[model samples]
Structures are given as structure tokens and as C-alpha cells.
Target: MPRVGLFITCVNDALFPETPKAVVTILERLGYDVDFPAAQTCCGQMHANSGYKKDAAKLARNFEAVFDPYDAIVTPSGSCAAMARDQCPHLTGSTIGRRVYELSEFLLDVAGVEDVGARFPHTVTYHPTCHGTRALGLGDKPIRLLRAVAGIELIDLPAAEQCCGFGGTFALKNSEVSSAMLADKCRHATDTGAEYLAAADNSCLTHIGGGISRLGRTPGAAKAPRPVHYAEILASTA
Candidate 1:
């Protein structure tokens, strides 16, 4: 078995720790040696996207140094994976970027394993994040994995390729536009009548999920769709 390093993104580390736990559960079941490098820190995605190139470069170097020894570096966040794969090479000039993969990419493309032996009895609508869809081109991998789960009703999310408006600093800089985009995404998610709204990136889920909660509080509003990470669902059991 190859040695794999789990690059738990800073967002998941601080806000959604369960995402990394689920990643480990599924990877271990697939028969891979997973290691967490304690020295690992933020992939500098926020800094990079916010135009702090110098700081981003420093963090990118730190990321390369920590995971360079591993045979493969896997992360559950597509945004972080995009940063490593797309931005790190330009910053650090290291080939380690090529070895980094998002969770779904690692499981489907690297491990060559599809059925993760999970079961979730609920209607699900998957939202494809911009970094995952445009940057990483992670088309259908997450959905295919969800479909393989027992007792899951995978519904199509309208405008599935549209941005959830949680583009890191984009949300902070353009709050109005971001809010509008998030509202549209939340509407689509609720329209699907799915109990859960799934996505590969928690950052996007955080934005959409917040909108869902706000909508639920409105008078005569429909039940909000709960945001769920793909890794968590894949780690579930019947």
C-alpha cells in the first residue's frame, strides 16, 4: 500500500473537523496508510485569492515541505486541492503539486475504488463547487460516489455548475452579489426536495447552508436542506 498524507484544509480543521475524520475512515477501509503531518498549515488559498502573493507563497512553500515526503497528498476540500494543484506549482516550483488530489479524485482516480461501502437513506442534491468543477474538473465523481451509496436518492441540482458565490475573499469583497448567488443556490437546493445538499467543499456548503437556515426561519418557508460533505456521506454505514 502507498503512503498517503491527509492534507486536512484549515477550514475543515477549524470548522468542520468531521470532514477529515470521515476521510480517514473511508481511506483506511480502502487499505491505504494515512498520515497526518502535524506541521501542516493553511494551503494559503485565502491569501492567494485575496492577492497576498508573498504570504501565499510562503504558506505554499510550507505546504510543499510538509507533504513532500509522502507518496501522495490527499485533501477533502476541493478548493485547497485546487490551490495546491493550480497555484502551488507557480509559487514553489515543486512537482509535489501534481501528487495532491481532492478526496473524490483520490478515491476514484488514485485508489481505483468506487464503492466505499456506505449507506445513507435520504434524498440528496449535490452542488459542484467552482474550484472542483472548473479548476479540478471533478465532474460526476462525487455524484457517482453518492449514487453508489445504498438507499440514496440522488436528485439533479438545477444550475449545478453555477457558482455558490463563496469564492473565498469574493464573498467578503462582494457581499451583495455573493448573497444573491447564495440565495439562488439555496433555492435550487430546496427546490430539489432533497433532505441534504451535498458538495465537496465545506466553504461553499457553509455559505449555502447559512442561506438554508435563514430561509427556514421565514414565515411559511419550506424546510431547509441540510448541508453535508461528500466524505461524511461516503463514510456512513447502513
Candidate 2:
């Protein structure tokens, strides 16, 4: 019965709108009252990563203004969730950061339910984004949720902890090195023979997905991996 604000991270809004819809639908099914303010936009992770702390601080204030009324805030992207959970507090001692919860973390802790009643008859592998793993310490929360899905065979991705090389603006700054890093991660995913490559961040998925599609076009290169955001998968059942 928690009142929650859904931070439909920028990328999810601009590119992957379905992700946030899935997030809202799932939260509703869990009996939580979720509100999505149309005024919400980018969490400023992109600006912060690019050394634009001032811009990020402004974005944080905007977030605080839009979301402070809720008991807690939840987001679909691990990167955005980590920013709210880990970075927003530094901008100001605003209560928003203290109350912010990533979707996986919220589902496992706040909602106190491991099984979200999702169903997917596909063999999938999970790739834990670095922020979800190291920053937020959301170990196995996603796995716990996905396992409860009715028909999914979730395989453990090889080197699942490795970065997909989409560290916000990391790919733009070092395209070659980023491409190399993603190639390795893609190879590991393909090696597992998983039909879908799942992760919590669409930004990372976009980057890795780009490499996957490019590789699919190349001779002898691996086929493209379908990147499924954790929220999108969860929404599938809702």
C-alpha cells in the first residue's frame, strides 16, 4: 500500500516507452498506487557522467520537485535507479534520495514479494548492469523475480557481471574500445545459446544491442541478441 512515483527514465521514455508502461502495470498489479508525472524526464546521469555536475544538480532538483510527494520513487533503469539511490543525496540532503528505490530492489524489499507472476516461454539469460550489482547491491533480486515467472528458463549468462560498455557516454567517448568490450559480452551471451539477453538498463541494452545487430550483419559473426529490460519482461505478464 505504498504511494510510489514511477521515474520512467529518459531513455525508456524517448526510445523504449513500453518499458515504463510495463513498470506501471506491474506495480499496479502488486497493489501499489503508482503515479507518473509527465514533467519527469532525464535523471541527469548522462550530464553527470560527462562531468556536468551543475546540470545534473538542476536535474536532481527537478526530480525532487516532481517526486517528493510520494513515499518512495521507483525506476526501471538500473543506471537511473542507482543515480537516484546513490547520487541524488549528494546534490542536496533532499529526502527523495533516501526514499528512492530501484524496481528490482523495491519488488524484493518494499513489496516483499519474490514472485511477480510473470510468464515468458523463452530461454533467457540475465546480464546485471554494474550499477545494479556494485552500487545498489541488488544481488539476485532480478533473478528471484524472474524465476517466479511461469514458463521462463532463465540461464545464467557467462561473465554476467561484465560491463556491456554502455557506460552512459562511454561509447561516444571511446567507440573502438567500447565496441571491443561489447563484443566480448555479446560473445558470452551468444555462447550461452540464450534467445534473449536481459538486463535492467535500456541504455546498456541499446549499446550492446547495436553491437549485436552489427555483428549479425557480418559474416561469421554472432547473431544479434534480443535485449530485454527487466521492467519490460515484468510488464509482459501485467
Candidate 3:
């Protein structure tokens, strides 16, 4: 085996540490020596999206410095990984941009591990982030991985390609539209009666999670709704 570095996004680090931990577990079981590089921060996605290319370049340098030694860099979030794989190339003329690899792409294209040996006995609906779909062009890789789960019932979301509107700053900048988009997503998730609304990006899940919480507290709901990351589910060996 090869050694890989887990580039846990800043938001996941601050608000959802479990996501990265789950990623680490999954990669370890797959036989890669996973390492975490301290001093890493946001991929500067917020800055890049905000049109601050200079700031993004600075963060890209940080990423290159921290991850250059590893054979591969894996991240549970598609958006951040896309930043490295897709967006970073635009910010610089350096070779760092060419070496970036998203987790889904790495697992499917590099490791050749289709069956992750994970098991989950719950109904699930996956929300594919825009970057994951458009930027990384990850079609069904997440679904393929989910289906390998021993007891999982992966339900198809009617408009799985739709955006969750949690485009980092998109939520704060356009709360009304973001709320509407999330409401639609939440309804579809509820329609599936899935115990979990799963996705690669926690940012989208966090947005949908808030709506799910509100819907859960409303009258006559059967139970609380919880959003789960795809990595967390896949990392499960139980």
C-alpha cells in the first residue's frame, strides 16, 4: 500500500469532525496508510467563490505544502475536493493543481476498491452536490458505494441532480431562495421516508438538516429527521 493524506475541510473540522474520522476509518480498512496534515484550512472555496482569487491562491499554497508528500489526498466533501481538482488549476500556473484528487474519484479511479466492505441497514436518499455532479462529474459512484452496504435500501430522489443551494456563501447571501430549495429537498427526502438524507458534502447536509429539524418538530411527524454523510455510512463495518 500507498500512503494517503486525508484533507478534512475546515467546516467539517469545526462543526462535523465525525465525517473525517469516518473517512479515515474507511480508507484504513481499504489498506491505505492515511495521515492527517496539521495546519490545513479551508480550500478557500469561500474566497474563490467570492471572487477573491488572491485569497484562494494563498490557501492553495497551504494545501500544496501540506499534502504534496502524500501519494494521494482524499476528502469526504465533493465541493472542497472539486476546489482542489477543478478550481485550483485556474488560480495558478503551478503543478499542484494537476495532482489534486477527490475521494470518490480516487477510490474509484485509483484504488480500484468498488466494494468498501461497509454495511448499513437503513433506507437512504443521496443528494449529489452541484460540484460533485458538474465539476467532478461523479455519476453514481456514491450510489455504487452505497449499494455495497449490506442492508442499505438506497432510494432514488426524484430530482437528485438538483442543487441544495448550500453553495457555501450562497445560503447566507440568499437565505430565502436557499430555504426554498432546501424545503423542496426536505420534502423529497421525507417523501422517501428515508431515515437518513445522505450526501458527500456536509454543507448541503447542514442546510437540509436545519429544514429537517424544523419539519420534525412540526405537528404529526413520526420521528426526528437526521442528515448523514455518505462517508459516515460507508465507514460503518457494522
Model 1's alpha-carbon lDDT is 0.91
Question: What's each prediction's TM-score?
Answer: 0.98, 0.95, 0.95
Clashing pairs in 1: none
lDDT of 2 at 78: 75
Candidate 1 lDDT trough over 10 residues, lowest sum: 88-97
The C-alpha lDDT values of all candidates are 0.91, 0.83, 0.83
- lDDT tens digits, residue span 143-187, model 3: 888988899998888688888778788889999998888888888
Clashes of 3: 0
Which RMSD values do the candidates have, in order? 0.8, 1.5, 1.4
Scored against the true structure, residue 214 in model 3 reaches a CA lDDT of 91
What RMSD does model 1 have?
0.8
Could you tell which candidate, 1 or 2, scores higher by TM-score? 1
Kindly give the number of clashing pairs for every candidate: 0, 0, 0
Q: Candidate 2, residues 66-112: lDDT per residue as tens digits?
A: 89788888888777877886777877556577778888888888889
Q: Runs in model 3 with CA error above 4 Å?
A: 222-224
